[model samples]
Target: MPLKSIRVLDLTRLLPGPYCTMLLADFGAEVIKVEDPMMGDYARAYEPKTDEKSAFFHSLNRNKKSICLNLKSHEEKQYFLRLVEEADIVVESFRPGVMEKLGLDYQILRDINPGLIYCSITGFGQTGPYKDKPGHDINYISYAGLLNLMGERDGKPVVPAAQIADIGGGALPAAIGILLALIERGKSGRGQFVDISMLDGVLSWLQILLPGYLTNHIEPERGKQTLSGGLACYEVYQTKDDRWLSVGALEPKFWSNFCKTIGKEEFIPKLGEPIDQQDVMKYEIQKVIRRKTLKDWLEAFADKDACVSPVHTLHEVIASPQVSARQMLQNIPQQTNSLQQPGIPIKLSETPGKIRSQAPEHGEHTKQILSQFGVKEK
Candidate 1:
């Protein structure tokens, strides 16, 4: 209930912005999802349906209310501005000039309420040359040089299953920025614009790898980084049963133990050597891992010093003991039944985030929210 008193006007439709607002809503913020009257959030119509709503939409948009309006219209714009007067935060994920064209940019809203924290999540940000360029998660990551660093060496860069740029790049940073801005607002008695660019966020994630490249003036290639797939000590291997396990024996002791236990003692001395000099160690380890089933290796390494782990599937992930112990999954009570969903990641001992309600049907709370905000429909 830490943010129970705060109200957030959520104008983000898709992943990044909605995910950011979802975090706020989870922590007890009054998140009013502002949507266009004609179609509402495009996510409401997204695929992979769960009963009547989208499983995708439900995953990202729980614990929020919906309000329908046409920001382009005078009356509705005025109504939104009126709601802004009482709102503590506004979150949107439009391109650079959309809000300005709609006459609802940060400056216009700031004139209405000086303490409003307005956050804009975009691909390239408002000031860059690529500001007006249209892009998605893939494009943003590629632009940030992140995509070039992923996948096998000399192979095509593989797209990750998850939206790293959208969720990690945009949403997480936007959430952090909003919180920091909120804290600053408490002291300054004024709010500021939070411009969250997915490209910038993705670039910041290269802190560890960038140091080497920046110091050496060398461009890091895909799968060549020390922690990536460049070394035999830190990699994945297939088992006899065709299942996979990961090896993270980066230290000397761990590598020695791993090689000795796997009967590849010759590899212990070659640990952390240059790729061309001892790349055969990777093949030797793969052969060793493939000789035994996944379960066999798991049992063998269960009590060992080697940092080995099973590469779990989705079902295995859901049933993981660590996941259960951490409460990463929970049953959220919906209308008549309980729907299982992801739990709050940030653990607050006393004021933990809660899923108070399921995602509203598009504009489900329009009348009620308008009335609550004292904006009577004309």
Candidate 2:
């Protein structure tokens, strides 16, 4: 309940912006989603539906209120501004000039409420050569040079299954920025604008590689980074049952323990070998791994000092004992069925978050939200 009185006017849809506000809303913020009148959030109609609601929409939009408003209309825009006067935050993911075109940019909002923490989650940010250019998660990652470090050696760069650029680069960073700005506002008594570009976020998270690259002009290829399958000790191997095992036995002690556990003590020192040149070590490890089922290896290493784990599929991840114990999944009751939603990960001893309600229906709280602000339905 740390954010119990903080009000957020969410003017975003899809993944990044909603996810950022979702983090806030989970912490007990009053998140009012001011969606487009015509389509609401496009995620509502996105595929993979359960009981006529998009699972995508259901997952990211819980613990929030929704109100469809035509920001393009003079009357509704005034209504939104009225709500903004009482809001502490406003999060949007529109293109650079879209809000300005509607006469509702950060400058306008800041004037109306100097204490408003306005955040813009864009692809390239508000002031860049690519600011006005349209792009998605794939384009942002590739432009930020993250795509080049994602595939097998000598193979084409692989697009990740998860939207790393969207979630990590955009959503998570936006959330962090908003929190930092909130802290700063308490000191200065004036809020600020947070410009979060996914491309910049991608580059910022790659700072670990910057020191070497800046000094030696080193350009790391796919599968060459120490943690990205560069060594035999840190790689994925297939088992006899075709399931995969992740081995992170990077420390010398763990590597030795893993080799000895597999009855291949001779392979203990081969962990330092490069997978591309001394790939025989990996090949031998793979062969040994292929001889056993995943369950067999799990039992063998149950009490061992090896850092080994099964590469869980979606179903296995949800059914995992650790996940259950940690309360990472919540089964929320919908109209006709229960939908399993991801639980809030931030655990606060005094103010822990909970799923207070499911995602709202389109414009479900329009009249109530507006009337609360003394702006009647016109």
- lDDT, candidate 2, 1-378, per-residue tens: 999999999999999999999999999999999988888999999888998999989999999999989999999899999998999999999998899999999899999999999999999999968999999999999998888888888899999999988999999999999999999999998999999999988888787676779889978778878877688888999999999999999899999999998888998867676556547888888999999999999999999988999999999999999899989999989999999989888899999998889999999999998889887795
Give per-residue CA lDDT, model 1, range 1-378, as digits (tens).
Answer: 999999999999879988999899999999999999888888888887776778778878999999899999999998899899999999998989999999999999999999999999999999968999999999998988888888999899999899999999999999999999999999999999999999999989989887778899988878877888999989999999999999999999999889988998888888868987546888888988899999999999988999999999989999999999999898877666777878889999999999888999888998898888777877
Superposed by TM-score, candidate 1 places the C-alpha of residue 223 at a distance from the truth, in angstroms, of 1.9
Candidate 1 clashing pairs, residues 3+ apart or interchain: none
Candidates' TM-scores? 0.97, 0.98
What's model 2's lDDT at 295?
99
Q: Using alpha carbons, what is the TM-score of model 2?
A: 0.98
Model 1 misplacement above 4 A: none
User: In candidate 2, what residue range of length 10 has the lowest lDDT sum?
Assistant: 269-278
lDDT for each candidate structure: 0.90, 0.91
- Candidate 1 at 187: error in angstroms? 0.8
List all candidate RMSDs to the true structure.
1.2, 1.2
TM accuracy, model 1: 0.97
Best-performing candidate as measured by lDDT: 2
Clashes of each: 0, 0
